[model samples]
Each structure stands twice: as structure tokens, then as C-alpha cells.
Target chain A: MKNNFYRAVYCSRCELIGSPETITAELQSILATSRRNNRPAGLTGALLFANNCFAQTLEGEREAVERCFERIQIDPRHSDVTVLEFGPAVERDFTEWSMAFVGDPSATSPDPLAVALFKDIFADNHADSGAKVLLLLRQLVHQEDLWAIA
Target chain B: MNQISSQPPIQTDDQNIARSVIRTTTSDQAAALRESFLVIEDGAILLDARLRVMLCNIPATIRLGHYGAPPSRGYPLTKLIAHSSALDADARTTVLDRCSAMSASDLAGIEARLVFGDIVIRIRRLALGRLLLWVPASRAAGESSLHDPLTGLGNRRVFQAALAAIFTKPNASAALLMIDLDRFKQVNDTLGHPVGDALLRLVGQRLRACLSQEDVVVRLGGDEFAVLLQHLDGVDALGKRLIDLLSRPYLVEGHLANIGASIGIAVAPSDAHDPSTLMRHADLALYDAKAAGRHCIRFFKSELNARAQARLALETDLRRATALNQFALYYQPLVDIASGRVTEFEALLRWQHPSRGIVSPAEFIPLAEELGLIVPIGEWVLRHACRTAATWPADVRVAVNVSPMQFSDSKRLICAVADALTTSGLPGSRLEIEITESVLMHNNAETLETLHALRALGVSIAMDDFGTGYSSLSQLRSFPFDKVKIDRSFVSQIDGKGGSGREVVRAIAALGSNLGMTVTVEGIETDAQADFVETSGGHQMQGYLISHPVPSDMVSALFSPQSPIASAPNPEPVAPAGSRRLRGHDHEK
Candidate 1:
């Protein structure tokens, strides 16, 4: 078989809207569908809900990753979807799960990275906002508190 | 007493009948409430909807006797308490207006304290139009305990309790004002706490005078006060007024002192509904107000919270900025007009934030200073710029800005600069350290000594942003600076026909030359501006007209053979005494 696919990592941030019950239900459904859909496409990543915002990193074939992001941009449960980073990666950052979840779906405990990311996004002085946001997400994974099995 | 003497006392048999009637008709809970009301030593009374006195304990009868006759069943409650002088006028009106507006089923409650001469009576309007009044047994003790002994203001405990009571009501709209007095510690440290105590008392008195009677003010321990204003829509103007009022000079024990207050206002039903959240929000606003240079009012907003969180995030990122190798140095050339060649390059700091792309120094420099990260970052920039500039043609000097904060510890900065020069194999004379006027404003021995030592090491010292500082000429005379960069403001206005801006630049350039120093005019863009600098005796010029700040990799081309600086022929062969030639280096070619 000819190796014809290139892997890319794409991350985006969005504000989660709706009540806790609705948001949790929506998140659960999203995870279920994302896992079911991404497994066949070999896409894997983690979704973090904190401070009413989501930071997700998806790694897979470049075409599949871009397509997944296209669907997420129009998702009704969230708004202000901003792609912080998108590029080829040597390997998967979230290889264990297709759609891992960090932080509670109901938005109970504050997402530590959300505050950091929001600051960078809205900063008047800082430049290279997207890369700083990616670093913040990478920090979350390194911290190990944000990881969900699947 | 006169009214009590006129009216007949309640018959003992009538009281017994009323108690037995209450015991037979009311449930165990009601009976228990009535029994407890009877046994309390403090004055106790219960009134019905029609102002009828349904029950009065012995203490209540004795207390009521002062204003009117002892109350009995069917006696009008309002008439009995009409003569009391201690009921606050404002509270009286509020209770009366609210009582008429409320419906029969509405279970609204009101708390008020009525002072009966030496005693304080606590009154609460309960459900079913029942009015409960009781004098706290330890009223004197309670008053003292609730107040700060030093300032005589309600203490933190009292404020918290008041907040809790206010939170229980539905649709309560108010503003929580958090106040912090600036420079109180300095007063305390220098003049001592006794004077500080007096100043605090004065602050409380001024604060109390500015507020309405209904507003509750509490001293939240150590130069902090919280004021809870009921039914207030916005407190911005009021907060300003309070800050102005509190900031006035105070005479504490024959010593004149000054202080200012920063206020943060958080509104109810908007910022937060609960007490703790409201307090936190108010405190957060206070932090912003203080950060914005104190002595001002800041209202809590979602954006303010976001900005504060962003600031915190930036601080974290700044700590890691150097560690992650996210910082870079950009170079902008400084061209000697006479020679039409690059004399030196200014190394500007840039943060290539992983997400933010290229963070401006304007935004992160101050933040890094606040986080105490500037020293290390400055060290990194110094070393990196020096090392990079070392690879350039030897004649091209590299100038790096030294922040005042970095220069604050002159020893460490001097050591770092020395280390950088030694490690990069760059001659001390090839490096220029640009310092603003504020850096020399301190004029301390250590800072001056540091400058002299660097000069002794053959490093060129430049007074940056001249004509903008407090003492430019006197400072020039005071220190042997090798160069002076006329500020960009004066340079931009040089083309403004016969403007003082041009005159100032000309005079500064003349002074630089007279003092045996090279003058570099900054921010020269237009030809008219460049001509003004050239004719005005400005030795060197730097700005976008030459070239915008570029990455480190692009710096060498500006000095390369056949480059802009290399191609422009020198109009005059006049070189300063030190004579650092730009294009004469044949070794690098």
C-alpha cells in the first residue's frame, strides 16, 4: 500500500452556550458521534470544557481533520469557534482516545487553561495569539488533569 | 411615663386569659414561639395587621411604659410607640411606606434598629403583618463588639452579617463598595500605627459623612472598608466622590499626612446575587482600580474580569517566555546622516508567543516588570543581541535599551552586560546601552557609579529619549554620555513650520555636540524631517525613513556590500572624535 496520507493537528476554541443539563447532554452526544465518526478516519483528540469555552486538539489525516473542523464550526451548541492552530504533526498528541474529554461536561470546575487562553485571545499587547493558545492546551495535556480515557 | 400614667394598666386576669387563649388555639410551634417571646429578658412585642398589640412581654411593657401606657390586647400598637424618640426617621418612613404597599399574603421582612435613649431596640417586620421588637440584652456590649475600637466603624463581622441579611431578601438591588487606602502602609511605617490609627479614624469619619443614613459602612480590617448601599443603581459617581473625599490631607496627631482610596463597585442582581460572589467581584474590581494607578473608581464588568484573568495568564506566560525560547530580538538601524552609513543598530525585544504570534514589547514589558521577569528577560536580550551583533561587521555597533527596572539593580545589570561582552567576544566599545531619562532620574550613587564603570569599560552610554525627561541638560553635564537620542516626539514635529519642537531638537543636538557626544534624532520619516535633523546639527538619524525593525537574520544585509547604507555616499567626511566608521571594514568583505 502506498503511504498517501499526511497527519495534521488542528485545535479550536469556542464558547459553550446553554444550561448545564443541555450542555452536558449535547457534549455527550458530540463525543459519541465524534468517536464513532473519527475512529474510521483515524482521527484522535481531546475536548476541554472550561470557563464556558472549549479547546480541542484533533490529530489525523489532514483532509479528515479539516472536515471534522468544518462540522464543528457550525455546531449549534457552541459559538465563536476560533482555530488556534492547524498544521502537520509528527505523531498524535491524543493517540489513546478518539475524542477524549477534559474537565466536566456540565461546566462545574473551572478549566484552568480556559482562563489562560481567553487572556491570550483577547490580549491587546501580546502577539502570536494562536501559538500561545496551543501552548496553553499543550500545558493542559502535560498537566495530566485534563485527560479523559475515550 | 406621662402617657402611661394617663392610661390604665393591663389587668393581670386579662393577660392570663390572653396567654391561655394563645396556648389553646395555636399549634405547638406557635405556642413555643409565644412562650419563648415571654421568657426573653429583652423587650418583646407582637402586633397584628390593624396596629393592635396582640402580645407584650414584661420587658416590653416596661420599655413601652416610657413612651406610653403598657400595651394590652386591642390597644393600638402605633399609638403606643408614637412617642419613642429613638426610631430613625428614615427607617420609620421606609417601614410605613412598605407596610402600606405590601399585600396581606406577602411575607416581606424589614430589619431596623431603634435607639431608646441609652438602649437600642431591634425591630423586624415579620409575616402576617406582625411586628416584632426586641432590645438585645447586651446592647451596649453588642454595639462595642460590632464596631472597630480604633475607627469606631462597623467591623468585618458586622459587614458580613449585614450582607447575609440583605441576600435573604428577594429582588434586593444594591452596590457593594470595596475601598482600599493607598499609602496607608507608608504612613504606618514612617509615622507609626498610632498616627495611622488616627488617619484611619479620619478616613472613616469622612466616609460616613459622604454616605446616606441607610448605607452601612464597615472597616474590613487594615486600610480596607466596605460600604453596602441599598437600592443604589450605580456607584461610579458616588465612588469618585468618596475617593476624593477620603484622599484629602489628614492631620493626625499634629502630623500632616496624605492618603488616597481606590474603590471597586459591584452591583446587585447584575454582578452577583450572593454575598460572597458580590464581594469577590468587588474585590476584583478593586484590584483593577489599584492596578490602574490607584485613587480611582472601577465598576465590576465581565470584561474587567476577563482582562484581569488575561493579565494573570500573561504573567504565567512571561515566566515561561524566556524558558521556552519564545523571545527574539529585532534590529532597527541608526544611520549617521553625515556619513550616510549605519552607525549602530537598536535591538528591540519581541515575544513570539506560541499563540499570540508576535507580542509587542509595549504590552509585555511592563507585565514582565510586574512579574519580576524583566531582569532575566533583559539579560537574555542583552546576551542574545550582543552575540548576534558580534557576527556582524566589527564597525557596526549594537545598541540595546536598558529598562529602568533592570537598572534598578545596577550591580546585576552591570555584571550581565560584562558577561555578555566577554562571552560574545564583542568589544565593550562596540556595544551601546540606551537608557531613558527616568533611569537617571533616580541619580543615586549606585546608578551613577554603574554608568561610570560601564564608561570606564569603553562601552558607549547613550541618554535615550532626550528633551522628554526632567533634567536633560543638567544630566548631560552630570554624566559623560557618548550619545544622546533626541526623542521621536520632537523629531516628528520638526517639520511643523517654526514649531518649538524643531527648536528643542536643534538645541538638544547642539548641546549633545557641545558636550562632546553624538546626537541621534529618532522617528525621522519625511524628507523635510530628515533635512531638519541634518541642518539642525543632528549627528545621526533613526526611524522608518531608514528602515523598520527587522528580524535578526535580515540585519546584516543592511550593512552588506552594495546595500542601502553601503551605497549611499557620505556627503561630509566629518566624523566624531571616537570615529566608528561603518563601511570601511574590508576584512568582513
Candidate 2:
């Protein structure tokens, strides 16, 4: 039964062809829709979108995770959908949110730090890129919580 | 109405609408009605006159929840589309519009259908302005017909759809790889179907893990699979990676299963623009890969198509050749070094093509084997050789090469040999059946039993083309053979340069002798080669140096009293001395 718990990570370039406002609305819609769908499927994950690039991780039962990934891969809004990692996981990292957002949705400009991390991850064909993305998202979430408290 | 008075009350509130509808029935009738509605495989939701969710079963609740709209009693039905993840924005708007505009009269129709993504829903009117929404079980299970149920990979339908989608764009460059698993049948036969199924699922996972998300992998059914790549760059590396990953051993159901993959690739716009042609080219390349030996990758080449065409034509010709009497047996004498006389004549098959003259056995034998024509052709050779050998001296034996296919059905093979001996009126002792190491490599008990049966018929078995296949030494120790024929490559290597080839021939000759088997060195094309065979303790020498394989009529001329070959020609006087000394040494034994 433990072997059934799986996690998958994928990164893609945003191909939402529209104005800035429309792209922002599309991005928000993706997050809201995925959250609504993931809750019923018992899937927990986080999405990081910045500089017209997106990296996401989903964790759940193997079948659920794979089905969710399949839908994401076919979505017209994403291009060059590269699967970085897909294997069994010991435990979930983002159990609190159905789909936690990592960057500000309303910001007109991209976050420089998030954009830099995206470039680093995509530029090198390293096997650990998925792990690196997960670590970055977890740190960012913790920092945001600290800021909210302050 | 009287039936409703006798019915018991329904236990679940979800069936309240059913209870209300059947209120006039007896208590038993009401309970049965409720049970029947609940037991229906399709999800059913009852909506009130205002399109409110008046009642629903567990199937409906689960199906709605999967679309992100878990229905509750009294929840407005039109609001479900707003929260549905199964539908896009346009589909949601369309569904909402259709529901809001529907009149009570429109709901009275047989069925009002709605489609969003792969889900289909049908709404039908019930009595008293109530409407029932039916979601078939197939959609409720969330499994599309495009998927393989066992592996969750896309099925052939999905593959065809993806292929058509690719070609819709002009100037598109993509590649298709056709993969077949080797030794999977053996695994299934040895380990059972459960393990084979588990291994296939694991194979699908490994294939998906190695490919990009943009690429599509599908189970083409059974142990064969295919992949469609969006780009042609790095295709070779991807093919090699797939072969490597799939060939790794799989542990399934407490059993370790080992299988290998052979890949054939065809690139679009280069191999062919259309889908069917591309698939055919890939299949042809796959044939080449499997023929080249399993666990390798082959790319589609224009020449492969041509070669395939040629092979097809040759196959047709081979099929007719057997019945047309175009096949003839050529006899090549194996000279005994000790007596300097012909002891046995190996019957070799030659295809006397009308236009092509004599086609080499090397070219057509494998083709015959693949087409399963080897068995009948082998029977013909056996019969012809036996009849011809009966006319020769009684001491002279005839050796006919038997293909591995002939051994597949040992009963038929034994019957064929028996029929040949009986019809030809030749003793079985004079007929030797020569088999290669491959026959023993299969290691089937049936083959061993067949060998014993043949020996029981007073026939001698020779291990032909030895030292060429793997585990030759072990094979000799396992089966007691009458003779061992050293492959021609070793004899061609004996140039007196004295490399390992000479030492190898010498060692094998000594091994065969110690095992109480006759050793014949093949391809002795030179006088020096003959001298070397004599010195290395070989019993017989067979090659052009002995004589070219002649027709059956000419076989008698070779043994005639005045024959130059039978007179022990004066090619080299010193060579005779070694042969004479070996002859004397053999007499002592």
C-alpha cells in the first residue's frame, strides 16, 4: 500500500496566448480549477508560476497523480511539458493545500528570484531538478508565512 | 396504489424521490423499486421542477464529486457546471445556458444529451415535472475507450488519433518507434500469465518514465508497444535508452523475469509522410531488428524496404520450388585420413533456380526455416539421400543435415526418417543425421527423446558445425554423438602460421577422439591443411580439397577404380607419408 503513494513533477512554458490581463486570469483559473478538482481526488500539490514558466508537483495515490498529470500535459496553456520526476514518495510535502500557489497572482511583473530559479532549473539537464524545485517552493512558502506573521 | 400500501419504507433518504414516485405501490413493491434504482450501474440524479437536486444515489454523488461538484439534496442542478473541472469554460457556459433555457415541455422528450470532454449525460423527463439525469457507468468509471485497461497506456485507437493529429500540420517532423519484447513468450510459458501481466505493466511504466511528456507511448497489444515522438532530434539516443531500460530484468509476483526489447524506428517526412506507410516502414525495420537478433535497434532505411520485397519474392519461389522439383541434393565426400578413402558423403541441398542457377543454401536455408518449409524439404533430402546411398558401397555412409525445425515435431521427424529408410530399402546404420549445436542448445527433453528414438532406428548422429555455437563443449558431454564436424572457419585459419586456430582444431580433434567420436575437419582447401588434419588426429577431411559437391550420378565416378581421387593423387608425396602413418596408427586402435 505504501508503494501506491506517488509524486510527479513537471515544468512547462506558459502558452496562454492573450493579453497580460487574460494570461493572469488564465493562470488564476488554472490554480482555482485544479484546487477544486484535486480536493475530491485527495491530491495535494504546489504550483510555481513566474516569468511565463510553470513548475508543479502533485502527490497522491499513483493513479490519481498520473491522471492529474495527464490532464495537465494536454492542456493547451502549457508547452514543452517536461516530466522531471515521477516515482513513489514516502510522504506528502504540501498536505495543507490542494494546490498551493507559490508566487503573487496579481503582480504585473515577474518575481526576479523565482524567475532566476526557473532559468537555473530549465537551463541545466540535471536529474535533481525536480528535487531542487520542491526545495525552493517549500522555502518560499515558509518565508511568505513569516512575512504574513510580521 | 394498493401495492404501495403493502410496501416497506425506504431506509436511505437519497431514495426519497423514488419513494414518493412509488407511494401508491405496496410496501414490498416500494422496497423492490428502491433497490432496483439503487442497484442500477448508471448514476441517476432526480431533479425537481425547479431543477433542484431533489434526490440522488451514491453513484451520482461519486460521479459528480469526480467533476468537482458533489451534489447535495436541494442543490441547484445548473450550479454544478460552474464548479466542474471536467468541462472547459465554453462547455460550462453551453451547459448552463442549455439548462436555464429548458422548458418543462422540452424535458418531456425521450432524451436531451450533453457532452463535455469525455463525459456524456442524458436527461429524460419523469412524471410530475421531475427529470432524471443518467450518467452511463463507462463515463462514471473515468476510463476512456482509448486506454489499455491492463497497463493504463493508450490503446491502438489512441495511437491512431495521435498519429492523425500529428499529420494535420504540414511540414511536421516526428518519429515512430515500434518495439517488441523478446523472450516474453518464454516468461509467460514458464512463470504464468499473472507474472506476464505484471511485467507488461512495469514495462509500460519504464517506457513512460524514459519519455518526455510530449511523447505518446501506447501498448499496441500483447507484448508489443509503440511510441510517438514530436521531434526527430536525439531519436537514436532515445531508442537506445528504451532498449536498455526495457531489457532490464523485472521482478514480478515473487518471480524474476528477464526480457529484452527490439526497436524499429521510422521518421516522418523522411521515411514517409503518411501514417500507414510510416507504420509499415517501421514494421519492416522491426523485422530487420528481430532478424539481426533481439535487443538491438534498427532505423528505417529505403534499402530495407527493397530487401523485404526481395525476401517476399524469394519466399514465394521457395514455396513453389519444393513442389516443382527444383531442389537437388549435392553429395560432398568426407575423406577418412587413415584409409585415404571416402567414408561418408554429406548430402547438401542446392536450389536449381531456373534463372538464378544454383542459389546458395546459406541464402535460402534460413528463409526455408522461417517459412516452415524446412520440414518437408528436409524429408525430401532424407529420402533422396537414402535412395542414392543404397546404390553406393555398403561401407560408405550418407549424412543428411537436419534443421532444428525438423526436430520441433519429433514424431513427424522420426516417421519421415523411418519412411525414407523403408522406401529406399537402405539400412539405418548407413544413414547419419547431422545436427548443429543449436539443436542441443534448446535443451528440450523432447529433442533428447527424439535423438534417442533416431538412434534406436540404428542411425548415427553427428554434431555438425561444432565450435561455432555457445556451450559446444557442454553439449558434447551431454549427448553422445557419433561424430563432431569442426566448423569451416577453424580449418580456413590453419595456414601453418600456427595461431590459436590450429591449436583449437587440435584440441577439438583430441576432445572428440577421447569422447569416442569421429572428428571431421571441414573446409580443408589446401594440401597443407590436409597434412595438418592428419597430424592433429582428425579422422576425416571435407572440403574442396576432397571434391566439390557433385550430382548423384557423378558420385559413382568419384569411387570408380580409375578415379584420380580414389587413386590417392600425387599432389605432394610428403603428405602421403603422414596419412600413411596416421592410417597405421588408426589400425592399432
Which regions of candidate 2 deviate over 4 angstroms?
A1-150, B1-150, B164-173, B182-197, B212-214, B230-234, B248-259, B291-296, B560-589
Model 2 over residues B1-589: C-alpha lDDT tens digits? 2333333343435445333432322223124333434565656665656777644555654544434324444567777556555667787676555554452555334236777666676554433344556666665443444468889787675465456445534556889999999999889878889888988988898888887545778999999999988788999998987886676545455444568899999998789766777889999999999999878999999999899999999999999998889999999888788777677789999999998789999999998998999999999999999989888776789999999999998999999999999999889999999998888756368888999999999999999989996745878988889999999899888885655679989999999999999999999888888878889989988888767888887676455232233223322221232232211112233
Give the C-alpha miss distance for residue B223 in model 2, angstroms. Answer: 3.3
Q: Residue B504, candidate 1: how far off, in angstroms?
A: 0.8
Fnat of all models, as shown: 0.00, 0.00
iRMS of each prediction in angstroms? Answer: 29.1, 10.2
**B210-324 in candidate 1: lDDT tens per residue?**
7764577889899999998876754777888787667644544534566889999898878886777789899999998998999999889898878878988888888888879
**What fraction of the native alpha-carbon contacts across the interface, defined at 8 angstroms, is recovered by model 1?**
0.00
Error of 2 at B458 (Å): 1.2
TM-score of chain A of each: 0.74, 0.87
lDDT of 2 by residue, A13-123 (tens): 877777766766777788888988999999998888778888888898877886676566445576656667677889999988788877554468888877776777677
Model 1: docking quality category: incorrect
How far in Å is the alpha carbon of B443 misplaced in model 1? Answer: 7.6
